[model samples]
Target chain A: MAPSRPYQPLLLRLLHGLNSIFVIGAIITGFWTYDTYDGRWGRLPLPQFKEIESIHGTFGLYALLLLPIFALYAFRRGQRRLIQPDTLAKLTQVGKPIWWYTLHRITNTVMLLALTFAVFSGKMMSEKWLPQGEFDHTWYYLHLIAWAVMILCISVHLLMSARVGGVSLLLSILDLKFRPQDSPALWSGHIRNWLSQRFKGTPK
Target chain B: MKQNLALTIIEIIVFISIIAAWIIPLLPKLEPEPNTGSLILSAPGAVWLIPVAAKQNS
Candidate 1:
C-alpha cells in the first residue's frame, strides 16, 4: 500500500478533536462569564450574560469526563510525546526543529494540566460566589489563574504546532477521511491489543 | 492551495484569540461594589443591564 498521510489515530482524533472544541467553547464562554461576574482583573468587551457560567460549566463537565480518557490514551500510546524534565534539559543541545518539537510537547502537557485544573476549580466554584459579587473565594481565584495558564499554554501549543507539524498536523485532527485499517470496527481490537500491550509487563 | 489557506486562517484566528486572552486578563479588573443590589444575570450572554464598560489598560 502507498504510504498514507501521517495521521493521528482515529480514537485520538475523535477524543482530542471534541476535547479541543469543548475547551475552546468553554474558554471563550468562560471569559464571558468571568467578564460578566468577576471582571476584577480584566474583561472582554463581548456581551455578557448570567447563563454564561452554565454554558461554560456544561463544557467543563463534558471535559471532566473525556479529557481523562484522552489522557489515558496519550499516556499509554504516546507517552514519549509528553515532555519530562530530563527531556527538557536536552532542549538546548538539539536543533531548532527538535527544540520546537520539545516545546510542542511541553505546551501540550501544559494544556492538559491547565484543562484539568480549570475544570476542577470551576466545578468547585459557584455562580453565587460571584453573583453576590464575592471575589475572595479560593476556587474562583484558582479558576482565574487557570485561565491565564490556559492562555499561555494554548499560545505555545499553537505556535509549536505550526512550526513543527505546520498546517498538516494542525489540520489532521479535523480530517474526516478514514482508512480501511482504521475502521471503527477494528478499533475495539486495536484498543484491546493496546491495553494488553500496556499491561503486558506490568506487575499485577 | 485552498486547504493551506483555510489552515493559515485558522492559525491566525487562534493566534489572535491567544493574544486576546493574554491581553484581556492583564488589562484591569472591574471593581464591583460589595453591596450592589444588582441581580447579575448569567448566560444568554447578549443581555446587558448596567452600562457595559471594560477598564482598558494603556
Candidate 2:
C-alpha cells in the first residue's frame, strides 16, 4: 500500500477553499473601489466609477452571507486551530512549530474579524457617498481601516503558511484528490450527530 | 516539492497584484465631464458651462 497521506477532512477543505476565494476577491475589489473613490489620500491612475463600487459591494455581501457557515465549522469542527488560552501558552514556546501554529491561528482570527468589519462598514456606505467628495463619513473611514487590517493580516498569513507547512501543505489543499471514505454522503450524518451532541451537552 | 510549489503560488499572487495595481490605473476616466452639455437636454443656464459662453462673457 502507498504511504498514508495526510488527511484533511473534505468538508473542511471545501469551506476553507471557498472562503479563501471570497476573501481574496473581497480584498482586491475592495482596494480597487477605495482607489477609485478615495484618491485624496493617494491617487492611483486607475479609472474611477460608481459601477465598480457596486461590484465591490456585491462581493462584500457574498462574504457576509458565507461567513457564519465558515465560523460554525471553525469553532465547532476545527476548534483546535482557533486561538484559546492554551494557544497563547504555545506561542511562548521557543524553537517549536507550535509557535508558528499559534501565529497561523492568530492570523486566521484576525482575518475573520477584519472581514466582519469590512462587511458591516461596507454596507453602511453608499456608492455616491464618496463620489460626492464626502470624505468625513464615519463608516467609510472604518471600512478603510478594515481593508488595511485585512491587507496586513493576509500578507502575514501567506508568509506564515510557507514558514510552517511549506508548499506541500498548501498544494495539498489545492489538490482535488478524494477517497471513497471521504464522500459527501457522510456529511448529513456527521452534521446530525454534531447537532444532536450539541443539544445533549456532549463534548465535541 | 510541495513547499516550493506553495511558495511559488504566494509569489505569483504578490507578483500579479503588483502588476495589476500598475496596469489598472492606465484605463481612461469617465469622458472628461461631457465638455458640451447635450444641446436638447440643456437647462436655461447650462449653456454657461460651454467654453464659448465663457469666452463671450470675457
Candidate 3:
C-alpha cells in the first residue's frame, strides 16, 4: 500500500493552460509579424499584415505580463520538493546522462527572460522609436535573434519533456483525449516507495 | 553542484549581455546628417512626415 498524491492545484493547472495558449499564440503571431516586416525568412511569400502584427504584439505583451505571476507561484508551491537536498541526491543517481529537469528549468527561464525583453523592446519601438522615424536596425536585429532563440529553446523543452515525462504526461497538459490514468495516485505511490526505501536505508 | 553553479554563472552572463545589447541602442547619441536638404519642410513635405520614409530625410 502507498500514499495517494494530491491532485494538482486548479490554479496552477489553469495558469499552465493559459501560459501554453499565450506562448503558442505568440509564436504564430510572431511568424506573421516577421512575414509582414521581413518575409525573407520563410520559403513562401508572406505579405505583411498590420492586423497580424498587432495581434502578435498584443499576445507577446500578455505573455510577458503573466510570466512573473507564474514564476512566483512555482517558487512558492514547489520550493521544498523541487530544490530539496534529497531530491537533488535522488536526481544525481538517476543514471540519466542528461540532466533533463535542470535543463528544462534553465531553458524555460531563459526563454521567458528573452521573451520579456522582446515584448518590452517591441512596445518601446512601436510607441516611441518607430513613430519618430528612429528606425534602429539594432532593435530589429536583436528582436529577430531573440525570436529565433526562444523558438529553439521551446522546441528543446518540448522534446525533453516528452522524453522524460512520457507521451501521456505531455498529452495530459494539452487537454487532449487520452486514456484515463490515476497519475496523482501513481506519483504518490512512487513518493511513498522512495521515502520508505530511503528511510529503510535500502539501495534504490 | 559545481557544474550547476558554472551553468548559472554562464546563464547570468548571457542574460546580462543580451540586456546590454538591447539597452545600448536606446541611449541617445548624436547622429550627424547631411545638411544638403531644406531645413524647413514645405506643406507637401509635411505630408511625407506621415510615412516612415519621409521622416528618414530629416
User: Distance from true position, residue A74, model 3, in Å?
Assistant: 2.7
Candidate 3: segments with Cα more than 4 A from true spot: A1-8, A78-98, A127-136, A175-204, B1-58
**DockQ head-to-head 1 vs 3, winner:** 3
Candidate 1 residue spans exceeding 4 A from truth: A1-5, A84-86, A195-204, B1-58
lDDT of 2 by residue, A48-115 (tens): 66677777877777776676677667655665565655655687896788888888877766666666
DockQ of each: 0.02, 0.02, 0.06
Candidate 3, residue A88: CA error in Å? 10
Candidate 1 CAPRI grade: incorrect
- Model 3 chain A, poorest ten-residue lDDT window? A78-87
Q: Which one wins by TM-score: 2 or 3?
A: 2
lDDT winner between 2 and 3, please give it.
2
TM-score rank, highest first?
2, 1, 3
Question: Candidate 1 lDDT (Cα, whole model)?
Answer: 0.70
* Per-candidate local distance difference test: 0.70, 0.68, 0.57
Which candidate should be chosen as best, given lDDT against the real structure?
1
Model 3: how far residue B9 lies from native, Å: 10
Error of 1 at A38 (Å): 2.1
Poorest 10 consecutive residues of model 2 chain B by lDDT?
B1-10
Candidate 3, fnat value?
0.00
Candidate 1 per-residue lDDT over residues A1-204, each given as its tens digit: 974455877877888888888888888888888889877777768776888888888888787767657676665566556665455465886777777787777777667667767766776665677778988988788888987888888888888888888788888878888778888999778767767766895423
Provide the TM-score for each candidate, comma-separated.
0.70, 0.71, 0.56
The DockQ-derived docking category for candidate 3 is incorrect
